[model samples]
Target: MTYRVKDMPACKGCPFYQTGEQGFVPDEINTGAKLAIIAQNPGELEELDGRPLIGRSGQMVIASLGTYGIKREDASWLNVLKCRWQNENILPREENILRGAVDHCTGAYLRQNLARIRPNLYVPMGDLALHWLTGRENIGHWRGSVFIADSGPIRGSKVLPTIHPAAIFRQPAWRSASKSDFSRIARELPKREPVVTYSDVFHLGVSAEEFINTIAALKGPVVLDIETKSTRPKSERKPIEETLAVIGIGWGKDVAANYVCDAALDEVLRAIESADVDWIAGGAFDFTVLTHYGVKFKWERCHDLILLHSRFDIELPHSIEFIASMWTDRAYWKHLTDTDLLLYNALDCAAEWEAWYRLAAFCKARAPLVWKVYMEDRPLIEVQVALHLAGMPTERGRIQAEKRWYEKERETAEKALLAAFGSTQGSATAVPVCATHKRYTGKSPLKARKGEAEVCSTCAAVRRSYIDSQPLNLRSRPQMIRKLRESGIRVPLTREGKTSLAKGVVSKLLKKYNDPRLAQLLNYWSKSTAVSRYFKEAWISPATGRIHSVYSMHSAKHRWSCQKPNMQQTKRPEKVLESLGDIVETAE
Candidate 1:
């Protein structure tokens, strides 16, 4: 029989199931049951039949219990919500749910069940169920530790407030960890008769935040830097007979050079190219120059310093002289000395590599792993890492969106350049001659190709002006013009841009051949960087079939750095087979 809150009715026609055996009415309870599981509410089936968590929730609990060395038959179960709130049976007012939680009689029923069962351990599955069982207002705060019941048969016992198995079902990754949580419950069962407190079992609980914090702190293994001749006046460029030094060095995962320098220079070159460790200096300019001189040294890894300065935090000096002084720790102002320029440049290049290493380490240790990139040139790993870490700490979905945005931005920049300069190379109608010569000697095109002398006038003026604008790139005009005439714009390559065009092939940046975006950007070198020379071919990676650029995070700002091979340029696409394979490449 059922009773009202204000009035009560005795059990009439209903036979006393266990009352006679226990020698008391509903309030009295048995004292043999050791475990009590209080799930939130009766789902459909249990609500209809008037039982506890015996449906989906009960089945899962039983399964979890089995894993913890406890069987379903070993425990008595109770429901926070005695009745199921089915689709139609749910009350129009939440007042009933609140009453179920707030009413003293409801709690008394719990007390009666525990008193009859005498369960030592009570497990509350969810928030509401916890409230129904323990009438404490702040049920969650009191969850982990054992709270003595103010009114219950098995008062002063320990409680294990764990996530409801239903929630675990929704997030399966939580299963393994949650099972560990359940195991703790069984561990406390031994001291049950003495009523172990909640603090005794619940210590520090684990969460998901710490896992990614560590992954975000990874940095690369190699450092790189470059050197350049940015000191001369813009108009002074002339491609003449001059020797370029080649320094064969292994970078990243160090590999020995294929062709060692001559014996006379071996000692010095080997000292520089030990291959003992990954060594990176700016663009393999020296490498290519050496290659031109019959030194075909195969290289696998290299980090471009310009990219490091641009992408990482490195101090940006207004002049190359100042940069040289600071990074090399040797004054570059005195170039007239017998000292060699390329060798001196190498010193600054090594400093730049270290700067990148330090900055990379700093980023790895303190930053986040996830990011959102709205814009990027190649892949600015440090910036990506920073943005990724910041976003990962907050929202993951936004980081992915940012990555796509950067990809689109890079693509857009490529399309825009191709739109402006088309694929074909431009040409001049005539050539310029030098002012000193009265007649066109074809020596200095900046003067004129033929004519009277304002110093002399037969120059292809507009083309000359365009070429002059590219002062950062020092190309001897007369020599370039002759080469252009022979090679055309699209040959295998011409020392001169005009020569490539003259040969009917457009010689764009070697980096651009494989990557359209890089080629388009290379076309904007005049606007992009302070340089007179362009890259030859890229230092390719065979590991993933995708190119990897080595960059330091502070070269421009002083905290990071990197370098390209040769001088003042990134690695270009390789023209030959296996020229730029992985440093530690394998057949598989």
Candidate 2:
């Protein structure tokens, strides 16, 4: 029997409907609807029109949906509170009113409608709607992120929380983020199949015999994945702290098994070594962890999915979760038990395997040359992994001393500037005597009118009007220019006739002037920037005593990107360089 809104007995005698206030906005249940959208409440405009979304907010929703080829007439649209309040801000001001409305409306109306429609996907719009449905408060944390709503009107449905269109209009800056969220929804809407779970393919707490039998029956060219405590690789601050939780192996598409890392370590290693081709995502981290755990295998036979994916689209995230979202049809990974980490690993391996083949075919068709180059560079990828494992040497003491030296130099420069300019702490009425005017006056009355009477030789406004005007940091630029002018050297100008403060221009000025103060300021600026970016304590691993930076081999025109104390840009200090000698080589 098909349930209809007209058949619902709760519609009659309802306080909202009885007011003759346009009654309840009945659900527009589209027969083709694979997804349902839940909004906070209908506005006055929607109530007047007797529809779920009819106002500006509704139009925005329709337009956003249209981007994904989803017609407004082809989806179920409902509100948490079925009726709109007469007062526009009544819902937000009176929390109890909304609670009472949801409590009364959902039990009688929403749940019944959901049961009838039974959408595979549920998208809750705005914080209020999301809170009513998911019991979560912060929309910012959950926006565009996928989750399973287990205890609500939309239970057993894949829930994707997104910012409301009204919110986007209120905060214009959120438009880009909202669009991204809509794009994710678009990607997920077409996939309505039940996700293939780990329990379906792998058995946990199995004996060594069971594990061996599971592996032995599997075919060659298997995709492998490992579950660990943390994503960060073994470093000094945190020695290989991540214990192997689960090791998952996928044979072909459907066949897969998960071996408990602690219990079946030996069996897992045996299976990996026996496989003709072992496909892994982030091979360097996984292989290093496995080797650290004393599981020996042939590294030459391993195929890194991350490196391969980078070859095709270097900017795309190569994480297994992201890859699963791209390649798989189901959203099963969103929900899992605490002990199901092994299952998660198994599913990740399956996703990686699927992505590997799809990307291979995609590249071969669209970019055959790129595909060939990637294939030829497979061995080089392995070499890169080895290089990553061998971390760079860092002298903590020398780096700290360099950082201190830069800070002191900057402090000295700042103090000298304060002395020359007579600090901002000086009285507003006291103006410095202009050398041209030879009196404590140049434009005192004009400056006093503007409430900037504390004029100085290095004042940006004064410099711009009466002397050299450059679009550099006013406080430092004027001082640099004054030093150059005092040294009988003309400051270099750009083609636009403005004072040029570019690196090359500044370097030339410094060389010609050879002023100690100018050199000190430049050194201070460079060193301060370096310390903040590269020598932070977070970059050094307390466990390894060396900087273990992760390298992205394809960023910035296919050049390597070094992070975690970016070794690529780490300026060699004399003390450190003298200690390490010629062996201190930067990354290639």
10 residues in a row with least lDDT, candidate 1:
197-206
Whole-model Cα lDDT of every candidate shown, in order:
0.39, 0.61
TM-score, one value per model:
0.30, 0.58
- Once model 2 is optimally superposed onto the true structure by TM-score, how far is the C-alpha of residue 318 displaced, in angstroms? 3.0
Candidate 2 local distance difference test against the native: 0.61
In terms of TM-score, how similar is model 1 to the real structure?
0.30
10 residues in a row with least lDDT, candidate 2 = 442-451
Q: Candidate 2 has which clashing residue pairs, if any?
A: 236-542, 236-543, 236-544, 237-541, 237-542, 237-543
Badly placed stretches (over 4 Å) of model 1 are: 1-30, 48-50, 86-97, 100-108, 134-155, 193-588
Q: Across residues 478-543, which tens digit of lDDT does each residue of candidate 1 receive?
A: 443433344432234455423333212333434334544334444543223322222221222232
- How far does residue 400 in candidate 2 sit from its true spot (Å)? 3.9
Residues 293-397 of candidate 2 have per-residue lDDT tens digits of 666657666667777766766555555544455444334352443546666666566666776677667788999987887777666655555555566776666
Q: Best by TM-score, which number?
A: 2
Q: Give me the runs in candidate 2 sitting further than 4 Å from their true place.
A: 1-35, 38-70, 76-121, 125-132, 135-148, 156-199, 208-217, 229-243, 252-254, 262-271, 292-300, 332-339, 365-370, 406-529, 537-545, 575-588
lDDT of 1: 0.39
